[model samples]
Target: MDDPVSAQRASSVRRSLASIVLGFELIVVFLATLVIFGLSDLPAWVTLGGGALLCLIMVGTLGLLRYNWAYGVGWAVQVVMVATGFLNPAMFFVGALFAGMWTYCMITGSRIDRQNK
Candidate 1:
């Protein structure tokens, strides 16, 4: 019989890796909202609304991790993070950094999956 443990590890490497990075990225965005884009700098509604939207995306990504299409949603979230630079310039650098990390995880994770299989 095939080794189930090895098989499961390979499957997880391919999928869950991106989700892990995304979860971290969401937290970073939340912190940046409060620190980099301070409450006094922006309107209360934008700050609260943006924070709420990020929370929703994070939860949705967590709940949808089992599906392949959820990765598409993950990419969309990445773009949103990068776009937030429009409000807080510092996010441009932070977002780009995470985007690179996310890309690396997806590519390397997929390669590991193929190799293990």
Candidate 2:
């Protein structure tokens, strides 16, 4: 992959986006986990933050072996949160859904890589 229009630029952008997004998600997960545990006062907000962070990590996990651990953590936490949230049903689940779909899409994409190789 060179560039979208050129080949090089497109490949660079794709790789950069993966690294940047995964890095940010890891940071967010750590920060949110700390905030939720340390604060302990804002249960609603803290849980929501944790859920959000997990969602981000899940996004980072899709199909990259290096990110597989992140995907496991993110998806695990997200599933627990999402299952529990059914009682309240107030927040939008778009993030969680996207994360799941992204994982599926990434897994599907791996076939292309395998065939190419």
Candidate 3:
């Protein structure tokens, strides 16, 4: 009595739409990472090093930005930089300054999102 073929076509269309949505999300993530990287005064080597560490953290922190542990990991990174004062105290302080601001923004954004929900 009903057309199953048209239903299958509709399902396919939904799948395509979902794929497009996910692709857009990936693009947004890359742009956000770029902005985050751009906002810091980190040196080339420090940026490269931080980039690598961020990649690792992203693997674990994906879809968990609202979690306290995400902020904890960020703070830990800042603390590690602070503790490396022997290497270059200025570098550490500069990085921690940026890191602290970034963490503050992230926390505030999460709070806003929670409140808006």
What shift in Å separates residue 40 of candidate 3 from its native position after superposition? 23
Evaluated against the true structure, the overall lDDT of model 3 is 0.48
Give the better candidate number (1 or 3) by lDDT: 1
TM-score of candidate 1 relative to the true fold: 0.82
Of 1 and 2, the candidate ahead on lDDT is 1
Model 3 Cα lDDT, one tens digit per residue, 16-117:
332333334334334434554566566656755654555555445433433446546555544554554444445456555555655555556556545644
Candidate 2 residue lDDT tens string, 31-70:
5455555545557765667557565645545345343354
TM-score per candidate: 0.82, 0.38, 0.40
lDDT of residue 64 for candidate 2: 55
Error (Å) of candidate 1 at residue 47 is 1.7
Regions of candidate 1 where Cα sits further than 4 Å from its true position: 1-11, 36-41
Clashing pairs in 2: 2-7, 2-8, 3-7, 3-8, 3-10
TM-score of 3: 0.40
Sorted by lDDT (best first), the order is 1, 2, 3
Poorest lDDT segment (10 consecutive residues) of candidate 3: 13-22
